[model samples]
Target: MIKLPFTLPSRPPVTRIRKCDAAQLRAPAGPRTQPMRGFEDHFVDIVDYIVRITDEIWMERAVGRIYDTYDASCTIYSSYGVVRSVEEVIAGTITTLNAFPDGEIHHLNVAWSGDEDEGFYTSHLGHSRSTHVGRSSLGPGTGRRSSIRFAADCVSRDNRIHTEWLIRDNGAQVRQLGFDLHEVARRAAEADTLEHFIVSPETRLEGQTPRKLLDLPTDTLDGWARHMFHNIWNLKRFDWLARYYCAAATVHAGGGRVAQGVRNIGALYLNIQAAMPDGVMRVEHVCHSEENDGVIVAVRWVYEGTTAPGGVLGECPAGKQVFMMGVSHMRFSGDRIVEEWMIFDELGVLVQGYRK
Candidate 1:
């Protein structure tokens, strides 16, 4: 099994993934040295490999492609549960496509690291628009159109993904589909046992050194991400929003909620903090790409704590601990972050908290 919460050695903060639009991203990679051997020849680079494979499997509706793109022993971890094996991945794909026949995901950006020799790790952000035309885990067809955000961090070798951490903005989808988020979670939790809700070792972060601004280097993307997450979220430094982000910065806080400006962004975060007063956030992974004028960084993080009653998540059972998995993509111009896409599964968190 792939180890969780492993730290990668820091590299000199130089350019990596490039900034490009959908059209540019899909354009021919052109002739270049293939970093990954044994990969498909059409994939000139790692980004192209990830984007194209995703398109082939999801958008193209080629469910069989999973057999080719994922290793037989691949495992997918998410807040709801773990999906093991390529066969399970294929089955899940079929089920999803069956529910939303017209579902299509638009890839926003990809931040990646590693090399062909060992393996490449990628954090891919996607925006999905779909209609609930058939029965699904959410229940029967509602014929409602839904838009949501999701992110996946994957490790690949020899043209096949071996492990993945996937998080979807499920609360957004449920609301768009006109379902009661809490009720849905409560029902699902009833069927599941308490053992499933226990926090895994991978999500624990107690007894660690405090991540102080002065102690952590901010020149590198890895350091910068750690600093921002620890100081702002863990330390409850709301004032740092202005100090770290641009005044005009925009945050896409999943479920179609977009907050513009530092004030609004801080408010979005405060809403969550209000629910879990003692929640602690820890960065599990970091990757970045340098563009012409700025940098784009992707951070995978986890938060855990008890929930207080009457907040964004509504009433919670006393002493109920919630574990949240999230992926955030930030675009930095100079020293300030100009844009961010914060994605997490609020629906899953509710289920975890409500599960008895």
Candidate 2:
């Protein structure tokens, strides 16, 4: 049974539980409490607060307000190593907005784990749209447009975001930087052929990571997921998709990438292999919780490899080696996966692929 968080003053009971339909999996009602001041703790609440604080800080150009919204000791992990302080976060925000000038983030959905009293954690998936007018993360002005997707996993306590894991699509960003996607891929392939070097993460013995968060069906969904990834990415067996994914499963790769059904999912993976042959994925963090609604599994994984001939995006094999950081949030109805939302650094991959 799922119960509302007890940390905040009681919220009205969920009233009635909705039917168990994959289509009905939507954001829970409005956040438990509304943000009265700009600095109020926004991480515990749902989409509204996070989005509100984001707008106040970026759209409104109120960067200093983060000192109030984020804990003094808050730690944010991203492509760059851990951010040093709330001040750095503010600086980073300013740097990003300067490059895009009119940059705006649009959050689409949020899923959460834990509760207010202990600590509230939220997984936010969204995208950013804007014109690259000034210098941004992608480098000097290219005068290009952008529609890059990103994701955030944050935990809150006492109304301050305590920790976070942020991922963005760098591959897509590289394209927006004015380089042709195909050209980047070709460059990566040519470099790889000349160097004959590739980057990959060390694989560990399976079952090394323990499962203690929630119960699972007879199939052990958590183990099953890890196994499928091992075979598909490590063992090089894409055919395993027929068993793990439902016929109607939907695979969403944020940053303007999405595919539905097993056929499309298979094709996507195949495309990925063509681009980064011998690429391996290693799980860093895993959480699976079965609630009144259904089962949700969130896993943080990393992929590192060299670009090859069968790149997924418009890029061709450049043989440039790179590592991508990403997270996968999946929902299951009964035993099979019904839907998924995932993230990776698209721009970072391209930069590495084209590196001389």
Best by TM-score: 1
Tens-place lDDT per residue, model 2, 67-175, is: 8779887788754346647877877887887888888766554555455566756666666888888865445687888887777888776657879988987666776
lDDT per residue for candidate 1 within 319-353, as digits (tens), equals: 77778889998887656788899998888888888
The alpha-carbon lDDT assigned to residue 109 of candidate 2 equals: 48
Deviation of model 1 at 272, angstroms: 0.9
lDDT of 2: 0.63
Error of 1 at 174 (Å): 0.6
Q: How close is candidate 2 to the true structure, as a TM-score?
A: 0.68
lDDT of each: 0.79, 0.63
The TM-score values for the models, in the order shown, are 0.88, 0.68
Candidate 1, superposed: residue stretches over 4 Å from native: 1-29, 193-214, 291-293
